[model samples]
Target: MASTSSYSSSPCAACKFLRRKCMPDCIFAPYFPPEEPQKFANVHKIFGASNVSKLLNEVPPHQREDAVNSLAYEAEARIKDPVYGCVGAISVLQRQVMRLQKELDATNADLFRYTCNEMPTTQPAGAGIRRINEAAAGASSYPQSSVYYYNPSPWNNDLCGDGYQRGGDNNM
Candidate 1:
């Protein structure tokens, strides 16, 4: 009996979809470039030295110098310009703030766990009570949160919060 079945086994996903030789690291951390040029170059385009040099040359002279100098002063200044703007910088700062906030929250939680409910000295062994408490205290000393409001605080007006006067007085 002649079986007209086209159900043949295909190459592995790494080989077929990624178009690269199926390897362990490539399957896991595919974005990481291969150690040796040839192994990594297997599935990716290879740019010649001349092409890369040409691209470098195409960069503006000031930019090229800045890159070489390890001081991107002009680039930093451009980030503040209204025309160039700072959307990217602001996003990066936001991400950094979020990361710091997470760290702060984790430290505060550890501190509260060690101090608020239980006596300080009797905390479980290796609780890092002292260090966590110190870190939380330090973080609380700084006012890092940003609030933008034309009128006044969005929260209760009577309480004296950051950027607000005491006793619910706006004039103060």
Candidate 2:
């Protein structure tokens, strides 16, 4: 048997798939190593080998790696989920982010409610009522009142008890 040192290194996946010699300056040599045949296979299946080669030729060498990664990710996503693929995954992640944000907002609102309830009413009850009215009037003057105005008077039973009377109206 020939010595191991005498045996030449294997060609890259691209070169091997194309049944051609892997040149030192081959574009696919770095990205499509001989060890990972699946990378090249995925790329080839999604975007034909000729198209990939052309794309590599058109773009600068530095950008090729990122392009290859994007291509591979898209190919894998497509193979796994042919119907919606990467777009579906992205949409699902966006929805999750939105849900988490809403939960965070609710938690913050609860914290604010708890903190406000804990603070001692230094001023007379009438003065607090006056301040609330003033804040409401000020908020109404602005077009975007929702951002500035938060009804501290608890509307739900979970947050605050119906201990404080509001202008003789115990409904709230």
lDDT of each: 0.37, 0.65
Error of model 2, residue 132, in angstroms:
21
Best by the lDDT measure: 2
TM values, all candidates:
0.23, 0.62
Error (Å) of candidate 1 at residue 131 is 15
lDDT tens string, model 1, 1-172? 1112222233232244345454442221222232323322322223332343354467664454333222123233343553443556677889998887656555544444444433345555542223232333334332235311122232334221233434434453
Candidate 2 lDDT over 1-172, as tens digits, reads 1011211377888888888987777778878877778988988988899999999899897798888888889988888888887998999999998887656556645654654554356744433222222233324232333332333334332333334333333465
Q: Give me candidate 1's TM-score against the actual structure.
A: 0.23
**Pairs that collide, model 1:** 158-168
Which sections of candidate 2 miss by over 4 Å?
A: 1-8, 123-172
Q: Give per-candidate clash totals.
A: 1, 0
